[model samples]
Target: MNTDFLVIGASITGINVARELKQRFPDTTVVVIDKESGCARHSSGRNSGLLDAGFSWSPDTLKARFCKQGNQQLSDYCERNGIPLNRCGELVIARDGDELSDLDEIQRRAEGNGVKLEPVTARQAREIEPRARVHEQALFFPSSASVDPAAVMRQMEQDARDAGVRFYYETSFLRKAGDEFVTTLGTVQAGYVVNCAGLYADQIAQQFGFAGNYRLLPLKHNYLESSEVPGAFRTHVTAAADLSGSYPGTQIFLGVDGKARLGPAVKPALWREQYHGAEGFHPFEMSSVVTTGIGQMFQGGGEICRACLQRFTGSTHSRLITAGSRLVEGIRASDYRDWARPEIQPQLVNTETHRMVSDFIVEGDGKSMHLLNTVSPVFTCGLPLASHICDQVAAATGR
Candidate 1:
């Protein structure tokens, strides 16, 4: 196969890159390949589907740069495509006075990132979500929304196909063969390559001499579906912050259908694709992940270990209920019996620093570009991130 631009991994990022490239360079051929039978079978399809309003990171980070815009663009995309969207918004509440400052920090980030965040009194918060609890004040993200991820992805794939972006499903990238790539399907000769392979992106990029110091640290994210009627909660609700200062703690995410979900226990996984018991098991990857995790636990003054213990060593449902109960009333273990589809977060780690990377990493030269650490909120940031990546591709290929 020969194409002007070849995109590996047909998830949100890869699909958007192909579509954007085709849009920008109409004369050039753009193609996307994925090992799955269809697009977004992995992380993209299994996400929480919460369109973030971009207050998580500082303004200096790339995540901040893309998230707010990505949220708006994606919200617009859903509306234009007639996809269902619940504009339920999100509430960041404080469990107590100790965590109140974190809300302030998040509000500061919201302002810095040029996103609107409303400071609501506890009464106002309850007015928004009757079950919501707050110590004094809570931050409301009006732009925050949710959709059926699978629905959005199907629409996006269709959009890409309609735009003349060719997709080769069940096609795997094998190796680089001298200015071209050897894939399971056939030899692919492309002018430029973009890697968005998720779990295996770092491994693929290593072949192209990028992502040398970065490696995939897969975190298994699982959510609990609430049995209560839809609209059990009027909006997504969560506490201020957790140990890592990110919002990975117990919280409830409302789907586009208004169903409440609690979870996303971000625990370290044994392998890259270790979604369930022994599924997608890779002995080599497991060994590497265990060793790396052990090393990180020792180096971070046991911070990683403490975080792991707090998150991983428990009945996941009970932990979620406990944490989520603090944010809103009426959370019980029985109501959250069903576990949603679990996903592996292909998080990137700086091997040398023994730290998890919180921002997106893009590395490229002339031949190829690699996107690493495109983790949570990436689905929300897909459009803008795709645009940024295309800019990198243009610069690298002189397009």
Candidate 2:
């Protein structure tokens, strides 16, 4: 198949790119390729689904811009397409009495990003959430909301097909065969190629002399839900904790069917695509073995959940030793249950700096662009990010 625009990876970014590309060049042929059977089967499918308020990233970066705009665009898309969305705002609590300054910093960053935020007293925070414990103050992001990430992508695939865009599923990109790409299915030529394959994007772009010193530092997170906290969180609530200590800051969301979900114990991962005991799965293998740190083991999914629980903050790390029965005043230890499925987030580690890349990185000219980092809140910012990429492509292709 010969296509004018070839998009690699059917994650939200690639799907949106295909949609925008087709919209820009109605007469041109656009082809989107993915190795999976359908879209959002990987990172897009396995995520917390919490819409970002753009208060985390620096205001002077692409993340702040796209995330802020994408929040609204995606919400509108969901509303128009009949997809589910929860506009229940967010409450950013302090990790401790000392973390109020961090909340203040986030508020300042939100202001710089043009995101609306207001500080609420602890009394008000309790009024908003009767069960959750909070500090003396919390930042309220009115724009923060939640959406069904997988559902959004499913609708996108259908809409893209209806828009005359070609989709090649169950087809994997192998290598560049002269003017075409050699895939598991067959060889195909494209005028321009875009790499948005979240996990393996580095390998793909490196073949084209892109992604200089970037490597994926896959971070794994497990969802721990309270067995009986249903309808507890009226609005999504998170902590204004520092980035250190592998702090998987807690978040209480009014989840599907009115159940309350919590905790995403974030930890660096050894495997990018496979989780221990996750249905006896492995992406590609040569029977290699690697050991975890002291007092750590990954036998399977259940073991992974157990290991993550060790680092998980559960309900109250801030008040673990500081508070008493109030931490579990209405919540019980047995109420803490983890979801069977876990999510893996893509984090690009800059080998040059030995630090994680905080902002989104795009490489290559408009003709061939690669989305280097598609992490948290990306689904929330998909629409604006796609438009930005489309603009770059238009200028590069002189379309």
Candidate 3:
């Protein structure tokens, strides 16, 4: 075999997997490939750029366990390598009486998952952010942090390169040629392959006949920038309320650069992994913007519904709407100069059942392995997950 392992994606997942493999087996030859000319062209590069100290996961799952560990690991890495990371923490604000109950439930989940969370009064939340308008209560997690996603991804690429792992940019894995894989440039004979192909992971897994269990449902997450909060403290903020019945809740955030932004409204898309505005603006991208606005309104409850209705009507939704109204006070929706485009994230939708895979899925029979639906905090849990994947492969191969 020309190489011991071939990782088909250069995002955080693929690069961290390669890094772990190299650390475990220094003699093994590992190569990483990405269709883009550089790493993190998709979800990894475009995100809220938060470290996510507080994650929502069942206690028994790998996501819950690894998320906390990964948060610490990622923060340590940033500090060691001089990567820019903001331990800004996160505040889940409760805007109404009902949201207080949701905040309490989140606190219970966090405690069970071994994550630290504290209930704070509106006064305390105001102390954290004088401009924050949490009318009822709030949940504060001091461990949450944010980082420049692009910087962290670039650092991972540099680390992998320094560790002697080969990387090929503008290269794509076309298909499987018997037991070996064929790429656009050449064929690579490898003993085993790892598919961390973020948005298209399921497609790549099908080439190896291991993707029968799941399919990729691409969701477009959009972000609207804010100039209202200038030089704000480095802290990630979110809504404690269940905004339109989504998992992580509906929320707005401030990046490490101190720019507030809202969005990442989940809208289903037909294509597998399509990023809006990467090449040019498309009209279809606006379809989900309205839905996202509606979701935000629902999360805000009755008090904000009128504002949501007004802003979403006519061509106002087509262009940037300044966050001037009482619904999104202290935020100018117009401050969002341009859409940061859309990020194509892979959600595990079971083809047979036609339902979303609520949990992470890993399938293999010892010699080879495939990771499907490694979304969200997967980047945070990459190192530990890589170790687990390696152990699984070792048990299968008796390596």
**Highest lDDT: which candidate?**
1
**Candidate 2 per-residue C-alpha lDDT over 272-298 given as tens digits, one digit per residue, 9 for 90 to 100:** 775555543444421211322212233
Which residue pairs clash in candidate 3?
321-333, 321-334, 322-333, 322-334, 323-331, 323-332, 323-333, 366-396
Candidate 3 residues 277-322, lDDT tens each? 3444435534443443344434423433443233233113223232
lDDT of 2 at 377: 69
Minimum summed lDDT over a 10-residue window in model 3 is located at 318-327
Count of backbone clashes, every candidate in sequence: 0, 3, 8
Task: Go through the candidates in order and give each one's C-alpha lDDT.
Answer: 0.86, 0.71, 0.69
Better of 2 and 3 by lDDT: 2
Quote the lDDT for 269 in model 2: 59
Give me the displacement of residue 17 in model 2, in angstroms.
0.3
- Per-residue alpha-carbon lDDT of model 1 for 208-285, expressed as tens digits? 999898766688888888899997899888777752274367778898889998876667789988888987789999
Question: Which candidate order results from sorting by TM-score in descending order?
Answer: 1, 2, 3
Ranking 1 against 2 by TM-score, winner: 1
Model 3, global lDDT: 0.69
Off by over 4 Å in 1: 300-303
